[model samples]
Target: MDNLLSSYSPDFPVASDGTQTFDRDALQERIARVRTALTTRRNPHGAVAILADNSPDWLAVDLATAQLGLTLVPLPLFFTPAQWVHVLAQSGATALFCAQPQQGAALGFSAMTDYGGGLLLCEAPARGGPLPLPGARKITFTSGTTSVPKGVCLTSEQQWEVAHALHRGVSGLGIKRHLCLLPFAVLLENIAGAYTALLSGATMICPPLAETGLQGASGFDPQVCLAAIERYQAQSIILLPQMLQALVAATKPGDARLACLRFVAVGGARTPPRLIELARMHGLPVFEGYGLSECSSVVALNLPGAERIGSVGRVLPHRSVRIAGDGEIEVRGNLGHYLGEAPAPDAWLATGDLGHIDADGFLYIEGRKKDILITGFGRNVSPEWPETALLGTGAVAQAVVVGDGMPFLSALIVPATAAIDAAQIAAAVGLANRDLPDYAQIRRWILVAPFTPANGHATANGRPRRQLIQQHYAQQIASLYDTTEHIA
Candidate 1:
C-alpha cells in the first residue's frame, strides 16, 4: 500500500469535491492521524466497523485500519435496520466510526474522537462470533440476495492487486478527473474507482450520492448527473447498466454536456450492446465490464483501445480465466477468501456465472448459472440473454424472463417511462423478439410498476430477488400462463 501511494508524486491531488481537497501527502498524514487516535483509545488488531457516507474521513478510516493491521468492515448505507444489525453481530465488530452525526444513537454507541470529516467513533458490545475467514483484513457484506447478506473476507493483497492492475490497465487513457458515482463502501468503487484514480495521479471527486444526483439505488436524475460532469469536468465515471440506460434516455443526440467524459465503465449487471451504442450515439464514451464481490470487484474490463462491444473485454493481466465443464467461468490467480469455510487451497473459484472467453480472449457472459431457464421445448436458455435483448429495445426499465419447464418464455416488464403504454412496450418487445430464435423470444409479458428494495422486488444493488418477485406478483405471473398455477 505504501508503494501504491508513493508511485505518484505527493503533491498530486488525491481527491476533492469542490470545497475540500486531499493531496497525496495530506491523505497519508490523515491516515496516520486516524490510526494514532484509534490506537490511543482501542486495542490493536481488532475489527473496526465504519458506517458512513462517502467523505474524506471514510478514506482516512480505511487507510488507518489497513496501516494499523486492523480489520476493516464497511457497512453499506443502503442496509435496512435489521440488515445492519445482522452484519454488526455477525462480523463481531467491536468499534464503529460513523460520519453521520446521529448514527451513534441509531446504532447505540457513544461518541469518540472526531476524524477529519467530522466522523466520530462509536463503541459497541463485543459478542464473540466466529471469524468466517480467520485472518481476513476486510469483510464486505453482499447486498442481501436472500434475507441475510453474506460476508466475504478479503486480504489486502487481493485488493491491492486489483487496484494496481486497474491503474495499469487505464494508464494509457490519461484519466485525470474521476467522479465516484457509487458508494465508497462498494468494493467496485473502492478499488477500481478510488484506488485506481489515486494510483494513476488522478483527482478523485468524493461527494455525497445526492450531490451527484443519485437517490438510494433505484432513483436517478440524469440532469443532475450531467451537471456534475459539466461542473467537475470528470474524465471518467463508473455506472451500473440501469444508470447508463437512464442517462441515454434523458440525453439528446449531440449533447455536449458529457463531452468531458473519456471513459464510462458500466458493469454491476449485464449491459446490453444497444445501451452501449445508444450511449455512444449521445457522445458518452461508455464501455461494458463484468465482475462480482468474490473476485474482488473487477475481473475484466474494456479499455480505451482494446474494447469489445458485446463482450466484457479482455481479462486483467493479474488473473486467468478458464471455462469449466459445466460451462461456468472458472477464475484463478485472483480468487479471494469467502467469510465462511475456506475453499480447497489453490482451488479455482467457479463463478456461478455462465460465460466463455472468445478466441481473442474477450469474455461474453450469458447469465447466472442458477438462473438458466430450461423451456419445455427441450431447449436451454439464459434469461439474461433475452433480457439484454429486450432492454436494448428501449421499451422496458426492468425485465425478468421466466419459462422454466413452461412452453415458451414470458416476462414481467416495467415500462421505461410512465408515458409509454403497453402497446409501445409490446412493439419494443416485438423488436427484441425478432433477433432471437423461436423458443427464446418473449411469448407473454405483463407491464408492471418498477421493482425496488422497498417493495422486496429487488436487491440493494438492483438485482431482482427471483423468489420474492415471483411471489409478490404470483397472481399476475400465473395469469400470464392462463392457469391458476403458482410458480412452484
Candidate 2:
C-alpha cells in the first residue's frame, strides 16, 4: 500500500470520468467501504469477478480486493459468453460485479443488489472449487491467441514491485497525467498504467475506451483518441503498436493537439523501428518497450533521453535478464504466479521469445519462437519482423505474414483507409520489403478486410491469431501462387 499510496495526498486526483473525478482521499475511503462490504457479504477467501469498464468504481474494487487479501478475477469485456464462463469457473468466482446488470443477465447472472457507483453484485453457482493459490490476490487471464485464455495468479506484493519500479524507471520525466487507452483488465494497463500513476503522483484518466474512439477490439478512431488527450491535457499515455501508428497518421505538421503530450509508451507487440522514426518525424513523442504477463506487466521500457531506435530499452532495474544459448531471453526474479497449476518455482523463466541484449544492455526482440515461419528454402523468419515493417508503411492498418511451408512469403493486408489505392499499398509493401532479406520478402500478396478481435482474427489485446488468420484467408493464401492478387 505504501509503495502505491506514499506519493499522493488526500486531495490529489486518482481517476476520472467525463462527469466525475475521484481523488486519493475518496479512493481510500471507498476502498475501505468496499472492503467492509465484501467482508460482511461474502466468503473470506473466495474470489470475486469484476466485469466492468474503466471507471472510479473499478479501481475501488481493485484496491479493496488487494486490501482485504482476497482473490480477484478481471473478466475482459471483449470475451465471449463461453469464455467468460470458463474464466469465472476456473477462478472459482461466485461473485460477479459489473457496471450493467444487463451484461450480467447475458452471462446468466441475476442481481442481488447494487454495489454502488453503477455496479451490481450478483451471485452465480460455482462450477469449480476455489483455486489452490496460496498467496495469490488476483487472477489475470491470458490473451488466448489460439485457444482459451489461461489464468495468471499474482500477489499484490509482486504487482506493487513492478509499479514502484516503473515509477522510478520513468523518474524526472514530469509525467503528471496518464490516459488509460487499453482496457483496465489488460495486465499491461492494470499494473503499469493505473498502479504506476498512483505511485508516481499522477492523475489517471479512465474514460470508457469507446469515448476515445476504440470500438470493441477492432475499430479505432485515432482522431477521437487525440481529442481526449488534448481535452485532458494528458502528459503521458500507454499505447499498443497499432494505436501508435494510427495516432501518428492522425497528427499533422505542427498539430497542437499533441503539443501537451510529454511521453507515449508503445508495447503489447513488437514495434517496427520505422514507426518510431515516423512518429518522431510527425512530432509524436512515442517510445517502444516490451513485457509479458508472466513478468508482471512491463520488464523493459524506452524512455526519453535514454532510448534506442530498435531496442525495447534496458531491462528494468527490478528484474535481471540473460539470453539463453538458443537465443531466448531468460528472466530471473519475481516472475509472479501462474494459473491452473504453476510451473515449479525456479530462479529463471525462459520467455518463449527469441531476442538478444545489445552491448548497451538494450533488449531487441525478434519474434515469438513458437510462431516462427519456416520457408521451403529452410529459412527461418519471425512474422512480426516483416509484419511490423509492413504496418510501419502508414498505408496498411493490419498485416499477417505467413509462408510456413512455401517457397517464399505472402502477406494479407488491410488498407488503413478506403482512400488508400492499390498502387499506394503496392508502393508501401515495396518500401517495407527493402528492409528485409530475399527469402523473407513478400513474393505474393493479398489485401483483405480488417482483422479484428470481434471477428476472431485478433486477440483481446490486438494480437493476430495466426491459425485463425490462416483459416479465414485459406483460399486466398492458396490462390496467391496461381492468381497473383484478387480481392485478396
Candidate 3:
C-alpha cells in the first residue's frame, strides 16, 4: 500500500470533497496525522470503525489504518441503527469515528479524542471473545437479502491487486478526473474508485452524497448529478444501473452536459441492454460491468474498443471466472473470506450469481442462483432475464419477477415516472414480452412504489432484496396468481 501511494508524484492531486482538495503531499500529511492519533489512542482490539460521509479525511483514515496495521470497518450511513449495532457487535470494533458522537455513545462507544475532520473518535469496550479476523486489513459489511448485513474480510494485498487491475483496465481512456457517485463505504467505490484513481494518478472528486444528488440509499436526482459532473468536469464516474437509467432519461440526444465523461462504468445490478442503448443514444459513454463484494468489487468489465452489449465483458487480470456445474459464477484469486468463518482452503469463491462466459470470453450474468424460479410446469427461469426485458422498456422503472412454483410468472413493477399510467406500463410490458418465450413472460403484474433502502425493499447499492419484497407484497403477489388468466 505504501509502495502504491509512493509511486505517484508528490504534487499530484489525489482527493477532493467539495470543500477541500488533497494533493499527494497534503494527503500524506493527513495520513501521518491520523497515524499519530491512532498510535496514541490504540485500542485493544486494534479495530477502528468509521461512520462518516465521503470526504478526503475518510481516505486519510483508511490509509492510516493500513499503515498502523489496524483493521478498518466502514459503517454505511444508509444502514439502520439496528444494523449498525449488529455490525459493531460482530466486527468487534473498539474505536469509532463519526460525526454524531451521541449516536456512537448510544452504540456502546464513549466520546474520546477528536479526529480533526468533522469526526469524533470514540472508544468502545472490547468484547470477551476470540477475534474472527486475524489478518484482515478491512472488513466491509454487505447488505444482502437479510436484515443483518454480512462482513467480508479483506487483506491489503487483495484490495491493492484489484485497484491495480482497475487502473490497468481503464487507464487507456485517460480518465484523469473521477466523480464518486456512491458512498465511500461501498467496496466498489472504496477500491475501484478511490484506490484505482490514486494508482492511476487521477483526482477523486468526492462531493457529499447530497451534492452528488443521492438521498439515503436509492433516491437520486439526475439533474443535480449532471450539474456536479459539469462543475467538476469529471472524465469518469461509476454508477448503479438505476442511476444510469435516471441520467439517460434526464438527458437529451447529444446532450453536451455529459460531454466530459469518457467512461461511465455501471454495475451493482444487472443493467438491461436497452438502458445502455438509450444511454448511447444520448451520447453518454456508458459501460456495464459485473462484480460482488466477495470478489473484492469487480470481476469483469466492458471497455471502450472491446465493447460487448449485454455482456459484463472479460474478467480482470487479477481474477479468473468460471461457471459452476449448477451455473453459479465462481471467481478465483485473492478472494475475501466472510468474518468469523475459516478461510476457504480452495482459491475459488462461489459467487451466488449465475452467469456464463461465451466463446469470445465475454461474461453474461443471468441472475442469482437461488433466484431461479421453477414453475408449476417444471420450467426453470431466471428472474433477471424477464426483469431485464421489463426494464428495457422505458416505461418500467423497476421490475421484480416472482412465481417460484406457480403456473406463470408475475411481477411487481415501478413505473419510470409518476406520469406514466397503467396503460403505458401495460404497453411496455407487452413490448418486452414479445421477445421472451411463453414460459418466461410476466403473466401478471401490479404497479407498486419504488424499492429503496429506507423502504426495506432494496439494498444500499439499489439491488432489490427479493425476500423482503416478496414478504412485503405477499398479498399483492398472491392476488396475481389467484386466477388461471394471463395478462398477456
TM-score of 1: 0.95
Give the top-scoring candidate (TM-score): 3
lDDT (Cα, 0-100) at 250 in candidate 2: 86
TM-score for each of the candidates: 0.95, 0.95, 0.96
lDDT of 1 by residue, 1-488 (tens): 65556755777778786578888778888887788777876544468888888877788788778777778889888777787888887877777888655775577556456755457877654447754455577898886568787888877788888888888888888999999888888888888898788778788898888888788756878789889988999999999888888899989878888989888999888989998999999989998888877778899999888898999999988788899888999888757666666744356888898999888999989999998999998899999998999899876889999878989889988888888887898788889999999999998888877887767688766778887878788898778788644221
Sorted by TM-score (best first), the order is 3, 2, 1
**Of the candidates shown, which would achieve the greatest lDDT relative to the real structure?**
3
lDDT of 2 by residue, 175-227 (tens): 88898888889999998899888877888888988987788766888999989
What TM-score number comes out for model 2? 0.95
The CA lDDT of each predicted structure is 0.82, 0.82, 0.86
lDDT at 232 for candidate 2?
Answer: 92
Tens digits of per-residue lDDT for model 3 on 1-488? 67656755777778888888888888888888788778777564468899988988888889889887889999999999999988888888888888787878888888577856556778876554336577799999987887889999988888888888888888898888989999999999998899998888889999788999897767899999999999999998999988898898899998888988999999999999999999988978988888878777888999888779999989998788889999998898878899988776248888898889899999999999988899999999999999999999888889999999998899999999889998998899899999899999988889999999998998877778999899989998898878665654
Error of 2 at 371 (Å): 2.0
